[model samples]
Target: MTNVLIGVDLGGTSTKLAFIDENGHFLNKWEIETDKRDSGKYILLNIVNSISEKVKELKIEREQLIGIGIGVPGPVNFETGLVYQCVNLGWGETQVKEILEKETGIPVVVDNDANVAAIGEMWKGAGKGTKNMICVTLGTGIGGGVIMDGNIVHGVKGAGGEIGHIVSVMNDGFTCNCGKKGCLETVASASGISRLAIEAVRKTKRDSKLKEWYEKRNQLTAKDVFDALHEGDQLAEEIVENVTKYLGVALANIGSLLNPEKIVIGGGVSAAGNALLAPLNHYFNQYTFSTVRISTMLVLATLGNDAGVIGGAYLAKTYGDHIRKIKHNSYIKELT
Candidate 1:
């Protein structure tokens, strides 16, 4: 028996897929730019065809494959296998599970990508061996995943852990995609960081290399801010510091509520590395309760872009019976 599971990470920009054995070893991996012109159905059909072709090429028997799991960059009804909304891809109320199962003739499971990323990090990345953890993906928008007692926490609506939507600032806020003001992501995400940099340069009348850089590069991005920071540019450094402070405040809020064993930071902006992490850590320490004997570790995510794919595999392997057993074991231990 092949006992192998396939994991797919469906992102707006790229689609990543991987096949993994029971031991979490990758049997194969690949990525392709997402076909946005196709509707959700056609895109899924392509995935089905790709998987079938791969199986034939590898000479792997259909019976050997265990199951298929997908992680999508939007809200999903995990219990019913329906996507609530995929605004990034212009998808609405998609029945992904039914379509994938019909096309592939295999059991299909799906969840929000951020939730699966938490599973990935918990399984093989920074949160390894920790039963309780959270992952914050600091991309164009912040995405968060909650893992409590070793399982993904999907509340009544499967919209749990949407920390970005959480409000941290009430005024002087940028409008968010969700039509909210002062949303955490609007201030701390990569896009937010760049916006701050641009506004600072324009408002402060401060001497910054950013204007020259933007003239040369055509557009300013968070990467430019990091580069400027590296060059010891004062304005860029101040913007970074402010961004980190806001991010740390959000982290402290999350920490206070969940008190997770660790918080794993991921995504492109996290590429700022120590320059971002150090200041965020400092702010988190300053804001969070000091006498609570808190010991949550903050660390950078290790799985990178592969986290969603690997996490989807882990979810496929354990979402049903295995997850239930683990939860039961935890409850029993608490009772004992």
Candidate 2:
């Protein structure tokens, strides 16, 4: 029988679960709505119940499972499996690993969601065959993970590789969700790109395709901006230039500091493909130091929504057994 791992990606609105074998193949995957009532107390119960059902449905024996790995949308202590302050989930400090292990009678591992996504990419996606890289997810908000020397950099506060929170505009910039001004997320994420388009239309009377689309739809999307740019709209080009400039500078700074082998851009904005990467690369090359410019490559993320779960599975396969042994020893010692 093949040993399998369970990977969980816990988000504010929903949670994704995957069963992956030792060889990195996903055997099954599913999702469930996140029940945040009572400060997310029911979330774990739901997950455990779902996993039990899946195990029975698949006719998999408990002994055939290696362990479970989880990715949470907050800071996580890898050793303790404790999550700190996930505002979207309305969760404060909590012991995720201990509770889950006790409930399921299986070993558990946990880490930051973005960090797991980076690991997933490194293991089998865009960053494959590379040891050092960065993964940046440009969705509703920006998230980032840095992998160095074949390991995820989990800073003391679990805030390592927070590329999106990097300051981009120094002055007169829109506030970010993190309560800061001019964060890269404010200008580079999908929503941010749309916000920039709206601001441009209101501030200038530029004749552009975006204005007509906005007037008709009453809103614009990052895709709309890219479409306009592809159609040779001057205003759209300017907006893209503005967004990419910030991203380029931010990425260049990251390159200067970490000198990563690759930077994988993922999320909805990346779907723009070359339209997003072309100018972003131009600016990245322009701002990057000459010595490192030739070494770093910027590419799109290939794993998409599966990155987190895949990474979680990898974590379980790598660290779950060792952690479980350590915990068992500690418990025995305490009892004796």
* Cα lDDT of model 2 by residue, 101-210, tens digit: 99999889999999999999999899999999999999888999999998899988888978889999999989998899999999999999999999998787877899
Candidate 2 lDDT: 0.92
lDDT per model vs. reference: 0.85, 0.92
Best by lDDT: 2
What does candidate 1's lDDT look like per residue over 1-336, in tens digits? Answer: 657789899999888989888777899998877776745545677788888888888889887777788999899999889998887777889999998988887778899998988888898889999999999999999999999999888988898989899887777889999998998898888888878877887776656788778667667799999899899898888888888888888888888887889999999998989998888889899887673226888899999988888898887787544655887999999999
Q: Which pairs of residues clash in candidate 1, taking residues 3 or more apart in a chain or in different chains? A: none
Q: What TM-score fits each model? A: 0.92, 0.94
Q: Report each candidate's C-alpha RMSD, comma-separated, in the order given.
A: 4.7, 3.0
- Model 2 lDDT, residue 120, Cα: 94
